[model samples]
Structure formats: C-alpha cells, structure tokens
Target: MTIKPHALKKGDQIALVSPASRPHSAEALARAEAVVEKMGFKPIIAKHALSINGYLAGTDEERAQDIMDAFSSDSISGIFCLEGGFGSIKTLSHLDFSQIKKHPKIIMGSHENTCLLTAISNQASMVVFHGPNICSVDRVESIAEIKSTLASSTILPPVTPSLGSFPAGFHHTSYPGNAQGTLIGGNLNAIASLMGTKYSAHFNNKIIFFCERDERNDIIERWFTSFYLAGHLKRIAGIAFGEFPDCGPKDSLSMKSYQDILTERMIEHKIPSTFNMPIGDSSLSRVMPIGIKAKLDATNGKLEFTESALD
Candidate 1:
C-alpha cells in the first residue's frame, strides 16, 4: 500500500520551499534556482521561503502551509527544501497527512528535514527523497542523480563501494553479509530524535537502515547504545552509515579511531552492516529514495536498488 508519486517531466513546475531555515544567503538560493532550471524544470519560491524568525525559516505554521500548498497544487510536480538546520519537527503537527496522501508529489531534502520525509513515508505511505539540499547541490552529477530519479523508466544506478570515496571508519565490511529490504533512514540524529515520537521511522519488517551524522564518537556510542537497548539492532536487515559531516567540528575526523566498539556490536549481533558509504553529505552521495526496496551487499560493500520509488 505504498503511495508512489508520479514521475516528473521536463518543464514541470516545482517549488523551492524553506521548511527548516532560510538559505545561507540569497546568492546560494539563486545558484540553487539555476541548478533546478538546468534540470529542465521551472522553479518558484514558496510564499514564506525567505522569512526568518530567529533560527527557523519562519513560524512552524508558515513552513507547514508552504508544504501543504505544494502538495495541494496541481501545477507543481515537486518540491526541494531550501536547507536543513532545525525546526522541521515543529511543522509536523500542522500537516494533514490524510490530505497529502491523496495528492502525492515528489519532495526532496536532507539533514534535519529527515523528519518530514519520515513522516510523509510513514503517515502518508508515500516515497520521499533523501538528497542534497537546494543550497548545497552544486555539481552536475548530483543534479543528474536527482533529476533522473524523478523521471520515469530508469533503474537508478547501484552504489559500488570500490567506486566511492571512503572516509575514516567507513568501510564495506564492518560485518560480512548481504540482505535485501526497504531503504529506511537519513541523518542519524534526526532519526534518533523521532524515536519516542509519533513519527518514528519503522525498524521492523526487515529494513536496510542507512544514516549519516557529524557528532563525536562518544555521542555516537551513546545514541548507538540507546538504539541497541530499544531492540532496533535486532530488527534491522542490514545497516550502512555515511561518514563525513557537511558542517561539523574538526574533531569528527578523529572519530575514525574509535570505531571498534560499534564494529564489535555489529559482529556480536550478526547483522549485515557496512560503514562509511557515500551517503548523506558525502561528495559521492547518490539519490537514495526513502521507501524503495534495495539490496545491501554488505559482504562486498555495495548497494543495489531492486525497486523504484515512483509509480
């Protein structure tokens, strides 16, 4: 009963919505508009996409309304979040998932926006995109990946570890095995924050959970231990974590040396897992759909999509 959105077409009108925070700068937003245009789509800024209220882009209600407007619009075929900082969770209460389930459209973002993606997938039963935010996407490959995914009749490319730029502690075989399941996760901290809430992402029914974060190793362990105690580790079909943080302190680079503790837990649980895949803010990140079925070839350190996220 998954709700897949219609494939996007060239010249399809789309919106650039700021659900979390305002763009880093007006220049960055303009560049983002150019990138979307280069993909052959006409982009419009949402009504409140530029309003800023302290750290938030605007009030929670404003952000939620823009998203609702995008979903309810007939002309707009997709949405791209301006950037991820904080405040997406606040908008959840304002959204009407039942209304959204009837008018599914492609919505893409990453970082703190993961909560929105998770909620849409869980409540609306719709597929969502975890990808580079509007202000951060500056490359031809990244553009191609997102554009190609929303279009019809193409199997997204597989992520072969050998072809990716691996970061510290992020290798293909933290635990040797393979498993196939729905791709379900985004920023590790965002996912963790939703754990006790109504929007928590599913961990049961076999899932290839993927995550990325920019926190220190000790914090990672605390969160990882919490997940383990909650029985999440026992339910995952496989797991992959992206290493580098897009905006983190310098100490994150030293996190590589403290990997053994989590690695041991992976081995002990016997779950198929891989570390440091080029996901999240990594330069080599691919457009990973939130609810699609994929094969995690952990033994060989590869990820292959087995099902499309679009109808």
Candidate 2:
C-alpha cells in the first residue's frame, strides 16, 4: 500500500503548519505563506501554527491536532511545515496514523521534521517529502527544487557526479556501483533516534540517504555504529550522504574529517555509497520524495528518482 499523493494543481490549497517550531517570527511566517501563494497555491495556516509554547510552536496536542486537521480536510491538497526545530518527535504520539493513511496527501518538511516524515511514511504507508521547510521555500538554498517538486508528476532530474546542482564542497563517491531501492532518509540524528522504535524505517534493501549539520565526525561515527549494531544497515544497498556543513575538524585538520569517517564506514560495510548529493542545508538542495523507489549509481555519480512522488 504505497500511496502516492496527487500532484498539486494550481489554486489548490496548501496547509501551512508548525509541526516542529514556528517560523522565526510572525513576519517570517507571513513570508512563507507568501511563498506558497507565489508558487500558485493558496496557503491555509494552521490554528496553532503561530502559537508559541516554550521552544515549540505550540503544545504537542495543538501541533498534532493541526496536522491531523489538515490531513483530514478535503480542501488541503498538501501540508507544509512552517519551520524545523524540536517538536515533531513530541507530537508523534498524539498523531493518528490512521487519519494520515486514510487521507494520504503530501507532507513536506526537512531537518527535525524527519522524525514525522519517516514515521508517517513507514507507519502510515504513504509518500512523504524531504525538503526545506516553508520558511526556506524562497531561500536560494531550496527554492527551485521546491517549486519543481510540488507540481511535477514526472521523475525528478538525476543528481549527477559532476556535482553541478550542489554547492562548492567535498563531494566524493565511496564505492563504485549501482543500487535501486525505496528512498529512505532524513536528518541523521532524527532518523537515528527511532532506531529501536516501531517508528523507524527499516533500511534493508533501501537506497539510504541522510545528512547532518554542525556535527562532528566522531559523533557521526558513533551514530553509524549504532545503526550497524542495531542491524539496520547490515543489508543497505547504497547510501547518499548529504551536505555536512561545519562537520569537519576544528581542533585539528589532521583528525579524520567527516569525509574520512563516511569513506571508511562505506568501505567497511561494502555499500555503494556517495557523499554530497544535495540532501539538506545545501544551497539548491534537491527535494527528495521519501518512501518512493529510487536508483543510486555510485559509479556514474548520478542518483535517479525512479518514480514520481505524486501520481
């Protein structure tokens, strides 16, 4: 039951929600709504999208209610998270996966929202989006792809090894080969948090992709080990390591960098993996459809979206 959301048509209403944290401010929220309108869809802000409660946009109950309300609403063709922060994990318990499954539609967000994306896709059996939150809809980092992904029913363009779509950085191929599987990934820490839980997306026979920011290589090494120990990555076909900004060694350049850790781990696991494939926090990052099948050609350095996210 891999449910595909219908491609959004112009004039469709896109619900704006704060499943994590509210946008930077009311003004930022306004701008994000404007971005939605500019993309040719009406924006319907959730009731609690602007409610501030400690670090979260609103209480877990409020956030969960807003998400479910939009999913259950026939008028809302898609739902976009306002910002990425710490609340999606908290709101999960309150969510009714049955509601999402019954009314399957697009739910797009990135960063900490990974918790929700992975959960809904796995537990609810529907496609979810891995892309910039609404706050970044117009940012140079993710605008083009966001617009393209929302309306297209065709396959997303392949990310080539030339690294042309990516920003200037350390892009490399860990193992040279090809693999095709359901696209499964998100923020490394967020996805890893659900390792032993029912919410976790099983990695067996999947083309895994994950990313992080402002994290050290050592901690990343530990996360990888944890996944391996949990037997999550033992049979992964391949991996796409997204941008790791400020993840290198500041204490010493000689220390094994982020690149070193990923290179070593991929080689050790014997997985056909590659780094820097425009996953997140990267300028012009690709808007990937999670829970959809995809092909990873590490040798050719081109990751292909084998299926469209939308019907």
Candidate 3:
C-alpha cells in the first residue's frame, strides 16, 4: 500500500538536511531559510546541513543521521534536502527505512536525492516528492504552486502544453495513446547508477520519467540502452523525457540527436513516450510527485495525476 503523508499547514516545521553536497556558502543556507519563512513555514536546519567534507555535506554517517533524526522527530512536519550533489547514495546503507515508514512525513528533493526518494517509496511505501531542493526552491517562480502541492491532497489537473520553444535536439514525436501507472524516476544518471542495486527502481508497469545534464551523447546512449537491455524499459507503461541542459553531442560527426536515440529505443520497446517535458534542469521546471498514480497521455503531451501524492 502507498502511504500518503499528512499535508503541510501554516507554521509547520520543515527540517532542512543536506543528504548530498553542502550548500555553496552560508549565505545560500540563510537565503533558503528566509524563503521558507516567507512561505509561512518554519525552517529547522539539520545538524549537518552546513557541514562540508570535500564535496559532500558531511560524512556519510553524519548525513544519514540527520535524515534519521528529521524523520524521527515529532516536531518536523516535512524534510527537504539542502542540495543535490554526490553523497546521498553513500548514506543509503545508514538510513533507517523503518523510521521513515513509522513517521510517514513528506520528504522532498531532486537530483542526488533521487536515490533516497526511490528507496523510500519502495522500502517505506511512502509518497515522496521529486522537485527543487533548498537552492532551487527559492529560484523557482511558482513558489505558490509548490506550497499548494505540499499543503493540498487534491488530485492534479491535466498539464497544459508549456509555451516555449523546445530545446535543441528535442523531438515532438506523435505517439497517439495514453497509459496510467505510478510515477517513478528522476535524474537519469542517478537512476542508472542504482541499477542492479537494492535501491534500483522497479519500473514494471510504471510511468518512468528521467532527465540529465552536462553528459555527452555517447554516455547518455549507453545508459538509455542499459535500461532497455535490463528489460526495465519494455515493461513501462510510458516514458517522459525531461530537460537535459548541456547534454549535446560531444562530437559534431555524430548526426543522431539525443531525442533521436531515445526515440529509437522507445520504438524498439514499443512503449508510448514523449520528450521535452518541462521537468528537471529547466527554468520552467515544475514539481512532480514520486510514487503517485499518474496518467501519461503521449499523444497530447500531458501528464495528469489520478490521485494526490499527499494526504
């Protein structure tokens, strides 16, 4: 059964923990705290929220302990990652899935947090969010929408086509069909890294959405094909490709676009898929719910949630 966490209310305490990398500076943390306060929520910084050990927010054990403490604390109504970098995977083994299952509070983040979100959904059976972290939270233009998503349990309406030119290499493929399944996926690199591990996502009969950044075409192709070869792509109801900033081909000789490669793979699997979604590393990025029942209409380029991600 899917566990829906209680919706946020005004003055609810949100624990800000750094499960991945540390913020760029102390100012970044202060800015995030200000933004949270402006949104009418209390921001409680975790013990390791500002600590830095190389590129990570802190040691693996320290980061994991912050997450554990956040979930176990009765005062915290939600948990949000400080930033997404390179250490979340290291903290997985130290996490207490049972504590998360028992608390059942909203946990939200993206990028490196993808690993944690997927694991929590699978292991704790809780609804988690895939969206901007503390750094991106204040940068997002739709702060009100984000607040609503955290506070409301109402089913989302159909997503309208975004008004903007598609990114270079994006294709508006016309696959006329619709499919419904639980939403699962995040950063392509992070998701692929979890392959064969206990935290790897079970894409069977699910709507898988992924995006990448700063990766060469060759590397992207290998990862995309890895999913196909592993039989994960074949069983998915549909696929949604998100913004891939700076993910162009490294060599000019390669004529195949990233979209072309992805399209080919989707065709081979005979799965309905759409590209150029405004999720991931886009300025117009919208918040998406992980582990919620959603409908993907590839024909019209729309994704609708059949149920709310939170209670």
For candidate 3, the TM-score is: 0.94
lDDT of 1 by residue, 236-305 (tens): 8888766546423346554443357578778988988786677785456776788888888888777888
Q: What are the models' TM-scores?
A: 0.92, 0.94, 0.94
Residue 258, candidate 1: C-alpha displacement in angstroms: 5.5
Total clashes for model 2: 1
The residue pairs that clash in candidate 3, if any, are none
Q: What is the lDDT of residue 291 in candidate 3?
A: 87
Residue 115 displacement (Å), model 1: 0.8
Kindly list the per-residue Cα lDDT of model 2 for residues 1-311, writing each as its tens digit: 69999888889999999998888888999999888887889999999999999999889999999999999999999999889988899998999998899998989998899999999999899999988888866564365567778789888788653345435444578887889998899899898888888898888999988888877777877787788887766689889988677876655544887778778778878889888777775555787899888899887567898878898
- How should the candidates be ordered by lDDT, best one leading? 2, 3, 1
Candidate 3, RMSD to the unseen true structure: 2.2
Model 3, position 169, has a per-residue lDDT of: 33
Candidate 1 clashing pairs, residues 3+ apart or interchain: 170-275, 170-276
Candidate 1 lDDT score at position 94:
98
Count of clashing pairs, candidate 1: 2
